[model samples]
Target: MVEETIKLAYGEYSDLIKDKRIAAVQALSGTGACRLFADFQKRFSPNSHIYIPVPTWSNHHNIWRDANVPQRTFHYYHPDTKDLDFASLMDDVKFSQNAPKGSFFLLHACAHNPTGVDPTEEQWKEMSYQFKVKGHFAFFDMAYQWFASGDPEKDVKSIGIFLEDGHLIGCS
Candidate 1:
């Protein structure tokens, strides 16, 4: 089940899958997965902080807090337009008075909670490029895998983009 799940998210032909580079474990649920990752992040990157987007799932805050991981907020939703605050988000991602290089970010893989807005493929590519340039780490919350496009394969395009850019990512 774990292997199959990894293939579903990372693509069946992914070299990471074939090379056994992914470390995965089954969790009770999406919240469980997120909490486990938070714990792992706190344990491994003790001094690092997690950058979460504003207007995300409320549980995100609680989970990270319980894990004792420091939290930082980045722009995400624009209340006026009811859409993504792309410019501000980019500014944060680029570390403009926000997180530093090698910072960890929590990204919604698709069907972002509450807002239901997902970045376009081009935006994902740009984000991946910036992440590479800034040495940022992406921790994807893929709880709504097929909810964005109604196709699991297509919904995971963001992750694929990061992978294509040679990023070692974490997904839940």
Candidate 2:
């Protein structure tokens, strides 16, 4: 399957992803891609950790664990308000020392699966800057790109922020 077509059809930053700098590979599913990435992470950044939101795809934990990659948790959803929990998320990110280098962070591009909440543009920009400072890698999963807002551009805004900041990204 042609990823470029998929990107263009969804209108989710197809041009940027199509740039010669990116390297794309085929996967049977998101879980498969995550598993492959987990294995790759183990090989390339053996000491690096994979930071996932407190609540993400349940399969995420299994994929990384089965791949032999050490897993770490970061703040995301607020138990009380059931919202973005931006402050706690930032606090966790700011205080995270484990993301020293070569660390991978999993981000939901849009329509957060379970929470159905996403960070604002301002929040995304802040996180992008923070990640830049920490030298961390971002892995975005855009499965629900158009399902949330019915507009792909709005859905993938976070990823665009990273690209604008000159960050290399991997997505599935």
Candidate 3:
């Protein structure tokens, strides 16, 4: 099941999988996966903080909090236009002085909760570039992988973009 899941999420022909670079474990659900990752982060990167988007899934706070991981919020939705706060989000991801380089970030791969606002393909590409520049780690919560586009391949475009850019991402 883990092997099949990795193929489903990362592409069947993914070089990462072919090279046996992925480390994975089975979890009960998205929440479980996230909690495990949070605990792993706390144990491994003790001094690092996770940057979560504002207005993310409500349980995200508790998951990280219980793991004893410090948290910070980055811009995501702009209520004025009822759309993505792209510029502000980019600034937070790329230029935030408080967040050190190589910080961990939790992102909704598709069908973002609460706002249901997903970034455009171009926006995701730019985000991938900026993340590379900042050396940030993207940890995608992909529970709604087939919700946005009704096609797993299309819905995971954001993750594909990050992978194509040579990022070692985390997906649940």
Candidate 4:
């Protein structure tokens, strides 16, 4: 009952997709998605804390807080640079020595809200490597998938790179 071209394109794209080891859940909105994961994080890993970006959505803090999970902040936005503070972020992850090993880190997949800044491909790769070394889990909030670049596939490059680096990601 829909347009023929849209259906055809959907089929073609669906065919191109191979099953990757990713788990997902359906939620009403970004808030719902975050709340769901916060619940899961609290339920399963109660002792662990969630590391959120410096300037993420306001609800991110509330969701985990309501879930009774303690929160930690990491360096993400550089007010002067108006971009990602990769070195500072890495230092927090690598040298902070406060965050426990194997903690959950909330990552904005692309088009980070409020700032709209994202890391470069190379930056993502290095972050993935550092995450691997530190054994941190990357939980992605991809609410604005194609909203940044107007191309969904290009947007997925970040997640794909993380997956390629063997990171166990949680996405909704």
Candidate 5:
């Protein structure tokens, strides 16, 4: 079962692994990936908190909380508009001026479920810059990489931004 899952995740995340571009691994699924990442974060950066986006997949909160990692939230969806709250998000990110150096962040790779809202490419680039300035580590869960556009690569646009910034990445 684990091997099969690995094969599937590898096939889906091949671009990063084959290119020696990312330190990658296989996970049981999205939940497993998040759990593993949370564990890793807690293990190495014991004092850092994880910045989760508001309105993210609920299980994300559970996974991190269970791992005993402190959690923080940044703005995400706009309830009034039923879309991304880009300005509010940027402001919130900017406000995170003290999220600890080398802290961890989790990004939903694509096809944000339930709400179905995603950040624009420009916004992702800006977020990547913010992560860089804050010295945050990104652990991406690309579970639905092919669902957003029926093109796996296109679905990982957010991950692409982190890569462009030369940040070490872990994808599943």
Candidate 6:
């Protein structure tokens, strides 16, 4: 089961591994995936912190915090606008520049819970570039891939963007 999961998780992109540039793991689901990553991060990089989106799934904060990973929040949802605060989010990504570079960032791949807001493809492209420039690790939780368009892969467009930029990402 473990090997199958790993293969399924990474096999689609054989090109990535042939280049000796990718590592990955299998997770049970969204919560399990987040916990596994949190544990790995805490074990290897005790001083590092994980950034969570404001108004994210309630379990996300608990998952990381329980694993002893320091938690930080980047501006995400805008209550007034009922949508993504793009400018603030960009600033938050830039703020990671001052953080201990190479920190972890948790991103909802699609159907962001509670708000149902997602970045347009162009925004995701910019975000992928920002993660590249900032050297931040992106942890994608594609818990609801069917939410955006009733097509799983279509909802994963954001993850595709990150992959195109060669970001080392973990997904369930």
lDDT of each: 0.92, 0.80, 0.92, 0.79, 0.76, 0.81
TM-score of each: 0.97, 0.90, 0.96, 0.86, 0.83, 0.86
Worst 10 residues of 6 by lDDT: 2-11
The candidate that wins on lDDT is 1
2 or 3, greater by TM-score: 3
Model 1 quality (TM-score)? 0.97
Candidate 1 structure quality by residue, lDDT tens digits, 27-63: 9899999999999999999999999999899999999
lDDT of 6 by residue, 13-84 (tens): 657667766555556766887799889889887888888888899999889889999898888899999999
Model 3 lDDT tens row, 1-172: 9989988898844888889989989998999999999998999889989999989999999999999999999999998999999999998988769567899999999999989999999999999999999999999999898899999999999999998898988888
- Give candidate 6's error at residue 34 in angstroms: 1.4
Q: How far is candidate 1 from the true structure (C-alpha RMSD, Å)?
A: 1.0
lDDT of 4: 0.79
Candidate 4 all-Cα RMSD: 4.4
Give residue 72's error in model 5 in angstroms: 1.1
Q: Report the lDDT tens digits of candidate 4 across residue range 31-90.
A: 887899989999999899999999998889888899999999999999998889988898
Report the Cα lDDT for residue 114, model 2.
Answer: 83
Model 3 deviation from the true structure expressed as Cα RMSD, one decimal place: 1.1
Put down candidate 5 lDDT per residue, 1-172, tens digits, no spaces.
6445433544455665567554546677678978998898889888878888888888988998999998988778899999999988777666657455666777777877657888889889998898788677877777687788887657767876777687876665
Clash count, one per candidate = 0, 0, 0, 0, 0, 0
**Decoy 4 TM-score against native:** 0.86
**Candidate 2 C-alpha error for residue 41, in Å:** 1.2
Runs in model 5 deviating more than 4 A are 1-21
Tell me which residue pairs clash in candidate 3: none
